[model samples]
Structure formats: structure tokens, C-alpha cells
Target: MAFHCYLWHGDTATAQGPKRDTLCGDLSMATPPVLTRDWLRKPQSMLRRKASTPEEAVNWLGEVFDQHAEKMTHSQVTGIRRQDRFGSALTDLQAGNDLSWGFPLVGSKYLALAVIVVR
Candidate 1:
């Protein structure tokens, strides 16, 4: 499927596959070549927290994710999917916000996430 570039209204999907029957895939690129979190960080898994203000949950979350992503899943596909975005469904999972990726099928063990962003 061709990569569709839309404004970051915070309501677009990072990936949209072809018909259910469609196969082989390649996502067109965006500038700055989306970097993995590991690549984004240097010399360490965690970047020093600029601030740990508990009152600003967003701050703590940003730091936690920045560090965790630096250590875990960092695929370009995943990174680019998140590059222009701030948080991941993964974050919610860690924060006890929402842990379900969703069911692949009704009540299926697998979960799904819908992220919308662009850069």
C-alpha cells in the first residue's frame, strides 16, 4: 500500500494495510529516517530525567517510555509508527491505564492498538 501522508490531527493510523487478502508490503519513508528509541538514546538505556515532577504525570511517563523503548522493541516500523507521536499503547499498559492491545478476534488473546500521527 502507498504511504499516505496526512496532517497530524492525532487521528490517523501509522499503518493501514491493503485488503485482508493483500500481501507483501512496504511503507514509504518519511524524512529523518525514523530512529529507534535505542538509537535515539546514547550510552545508556535511560536518559536522565529532566524532571521527575510526580504532579506532572506526563513528565514521568515521557521519561519512563524514553528509557524503556531505548531498551526494548525498537523496530523502525514501530519507531516510525511512534516517531511523530508522544505515547504508545504500551505506555498505558505500563501505567495501568489500558493494558489491552485488543482482541485479534472476539476475546482473542492478542490485542490491537490504533495510533495516529505523522511528521
Candidate 2:
């Protein structure tokens, strides 16, 4: 199964990279970080989602990751350390701070998300 990757910043989000088996490679080979860095450099490329509250924004991202993992991997992911990291980043975003979180999916493959407050 392929893992979908997304980058969410402010009120905009976009799917990153092509759909492929993302859980079988090293971090250096992962596409999420590269796509995220590119997006951060050129954020105007991102499309806006419908207006939503901060909590809803966070929940939407969490649900996307969780639901994808459950559906594709056939296992529920809960109480994982990565969830805590994502929660911390969400808190930082709510606090008006920029933050980034990296999650190891399987093997050396990783997923990275950042919440950057662009002036």
C-alpha cells in the first residue's frame, strides 16, 4: 500500500509527491521532506481549504494521517509517540509559533509536517 503525504501550513494544504510505496525507503529518499521544503520556499503554490477553526485544522490533519494508516496498513495507530509530536506541533501553532514534526512511518521512510506562520 502507498502512504499519502500532505503538507499543511496556515489555512492551506496540499498533497505532496506522487502516490507510491513511501514506507520502504530511507529518510533521504522520502519525498515528504523534499516537497515540504519546496512548499515552504514557495508557499503560494498551496491551495486553501475551506475556512476552519484552528482545532478543526489540526483535527483534519490528524484524521488524514490516522485514517490513511488504518485503512492502508490494516492496523489502528494510537498512543504512538508520533501522535504526541503532532499534538505538540498543533499546540505550538495555536500559540502562534512555527513548528515542525517528523514521523517515521516504516523502516527509514518518514513523514514531515510543518506549521509556519507567514507574516
Candidate 3:
């Protein structure tokens, strides 16, 4: 099984993109990158991670950050009380709200690959 994530962009009500101010105001913003043929070239890489829950997704992201973005500060890396960046994202997701417009992880690369695995 593959991890399934839905990225919300534009407007669900009017079918338009989010307001510029709304996008610019939010701190933890994340938009799924456009799926490209180059990413598809290594099909197995996507399958390597198949998160079955929000917690699993957060764990996967944390592991990725630890491995790739070690230079980040302690606050950006810790998962204390589930109130960290990833934790906030999880809260938003659970409330049926789309993850706002920022990278939930520590690296710029993750912002481009913001896959939201929900089950």
C-alpha cells in the first residue's frame, strides 16, 4: 500500500486559489509539489514510505529531517507533547482543515514534497 495524502490549494468554496494574505499570513504552510515525471522515474522511492496514520506520517517526516536537515534548531526538531510543527499540522489535519502554507519539516526539500498520508 502507498501513503495517500491530499494537498489543498485554491478555494474549496469558489474553486480559486487561497487569498494572498491568507497564504502569506499563515506560518506553517505546505503545498504539495506538482507531481513530475522525474519523480516518477524512481517509482520505488515513493513506495518506500507508506504511512498509515497521521502519527506515522509525522514520524516519517521527523526521521527524514533528522537524516537530511540536522542543522535545524532544537525547537524545530523536537516532538515534545505533539505541539511542535508536525504536531500542529497533525491537529489541523485531524480537524478536517487543510495543512496551511509552510513546510512542516525542517528542510526546504520537504516543502516541495509535502505528501499528506491520511487513512
Candidate 4:
């Protein structure tokens, strides 16, 4: 079973030494990070995420947002339905597997997101 997720660059040093064709000793596989209880609790700390792939991560988030985008707000009043600076990135779960929240761009204000999770 494949799932989608979002991916962001973690504070990792750039490639200095010869690139290791094998990320985790397996050139054909990528060592995905662990999705533990803490991950569900505090995602910021982990910084790193593990999904089927980078693209998958983005798609999942897009779908998540698309579902409840209408209930968010008509703030812009532009009628295009765009995301605002102040919103939930992944919050509003209330107490179930559902949630709604917002996130702010740190390094770059021109943040970009990917849509993952194949239909």
C-alpha cells in the first residue's frame, strides 16, 4: 500500500565527499525516516519525513487541503480560494484522524508544495 506525504529539506550538510550512490547502503532503495508516535505528536522536530516518495508526500497534502478548502474562509474575497498566511497546515482534528492547520514559510516565503497519494 502506498501513501502520500509532504517533504521538506532538513538541516543537512550538502554533498561534500563523493556522493554515495547508495543513500542507506542500497542504491535501489531510499531509507525512509521512522513515523513514530512523536511524529504524530511533533512533526516539526522530526523535520525529515518518510513516504512512498517525495511526490507522494506533496499530493497527499494537496488532497487534504482540497477536501476542506471551502470551510476555511473567503478571506481574499477574490473568489479564487487561495491559502492564507494564517491558517492550519495540519490542525483542526478536534479528536479524530481528521485535522486542519496552517504553516508559515521559514527559509523561503515562496514556499512550494507537492501533491501526492495516487488515486
Candidate 5:
């Protein structure tokens, strides 16, 4: 089963509503990367933290990516796929170009997040 994933960016302060900028991953995946699934299986400590600033959010996301990258390095295909979906967004965030917010999927047994970037 394929699942649709997106990385959206926008400004929330406008009356026009959230302005979306697609940084990457406007595609469907048969399943999330193995490292991602494994990380999600761990305790939700990191996910529970609140990011009050864009810098903080970026830092948090960086850690998440770091974890994935460490394991992904063992598998070329998985690393490439994961990087394709999230690398640019992380790069942009690290460069101070945008802010990130992750919305957790409600009523789901597994941890699923929809990440939105605020420009």
C-alpha cells in the first residue's frame, strides 16, 4: 500500500492562509524507510518536546535526520530514498530559511507526522 507524503512550507501570519511551498517529497511511498519505522518504535520522548522557536524546531528535526542517516548509511537504496524526501528541507531549515512544525497523526497506533515548514 502506497502512502502519500509531503513537505509543505508557508507563512501562517497572513490572512490569505498558509502559503504552501513544496520543498520535496510530493510523492507516494510503499512504506516509510526502515530506519524511520525503527525510530518511530522507540520512546516518544523527542517527539513530545515543544519547539517554541524555528531554531529549536530545526535542531530537533536535525536530530531525527541524524538518527536516520546513521542507520541508512548501511543501505544505499534506503539512504538515497530518505535523503531525496527530506534532505532539502533539512538543509533549508539549517540554513535559517524556514521554520518547521510536526503534526502527529491522531488515533493511530503508529507514530506518523506531517511536517509543515513556516517561511
Candidate 6:
């Protein structure tokens, strides 16, 4: 199976497909012919954290949950479906604020993460 990423708004997924122009809608030559897992890596310093591997992602998610458990009420950590939105989700997850979960799909074929904005 190919990699898929998604952007979720809640129990209902806000976006169910890839966002890159090449992957969806009218294709463009500027879009790279090759996609790499590099999209899965969170920038090392941006959020004061990084996750180079699926394992690290899981650990980071747990840390965020633990640190914020006392303050969070209705919000809960959850899974994300793969589509084409890894970059955005990873950004939120790395920030460790409104983001909660960041991990790869069980089969290793896709990356997934969850975002929970408490507004």
C-alpha cells in the first residue's frame, strides 16, 4: 500500500487526502517526482523537540499527554488516519501544545498524528 496522510478536525476528518499538488488535483512539474520519508521528520529545534523515528514520536506524544493531563478536560489523545498531511500534523505534534499524537501507521506504510485545538 502507498503512504496516505490526513488532516482531522475531530471524529469527522476535515480532509481525507493528500495536499501536495502533484498527489491531488491538477499536477504540476514543480512537484517532485519522488517523495521521501524526510517529510516525516520534525525539525530538530523548532518546537524544542524532534522525532526522527516512529518510536521517538510515540514517546513524545506520551510526554505531552502526561504533562498536560491535569489541565486537559474533554480533550483526549487519539489516532490519525494517513492521507498526505504528515507535515502539518508533525508540526502540531512537535509543538506539543494543541497537538497530542504523532506516530506511524501500524504497517509502517503510512505516518499518522492527531491534533486537538482546545479553542
Q: lDDT for every model?
A: 0.27, 0.43, 0.41, 0.31, 0.35, 0.33
Q: Select the stronger candidate by lDDT from 3 and 6.
A: 3
**Which candidate comes out best when scored by TM-score?**
2
What is candidate 2's CA lDDT for residue 16? 32
Q: Output the better candidate (4/6) by lDDT.
A: 6
For each candidate, give its TM-score against the true structure: 0.23, 0.44, 0.41, 0.28, 0.29, 0.28
Q: Give the Å shift of residue 27 in candidate 5.
A: 21
RMSD of each: 15.8, 10.0, 10.3, 12.7, 14.9, 13.9
Model 5 scores worst on lDDT over the 10 consecutive residues at: 23-32
lDDT of 2: 0.43
Q: Which residues of candidate 1, in runs, are more than 4 Å off? A: 1-55, 76-84, 87-119
Residue-level lDDT of model 5, residues 3-116, one tens digit each, is 112232222221122321221121122222223323223333423344555445545555654543433325532535655545665565455443332322222212223233
Q: What is the lDDT of residue 34 in candidate 4?
A: 24
Clashing pairs in 3: 5-116, 10-17, 11-16, 28-102, 29-100, 29-101, 29-102, 30-101, 30-102
lDDT (tens digit, per residue) of candidate 1 on 1-112:
1111111111112222232112112122221112222111222212223322222333444444454343343462264555344455435333433111111221212112
TM-score of 1: 0.23
- Candidate 3 shows a clash count of 9
Residue 53 of model 5 has an lDDT of: 50
Error of 6 at 88 (Å): 16
Model 3, TM vs. native: 0.41
lDDT of 6 by residue, 1-119 (tens): 11222121121111123553333222232121122222223232223344454335545545544554443333332233322234554555445434333222222222223333222
Who wins the lDDT comparison?
2
Better of 5 and 6 by TM-score: 5
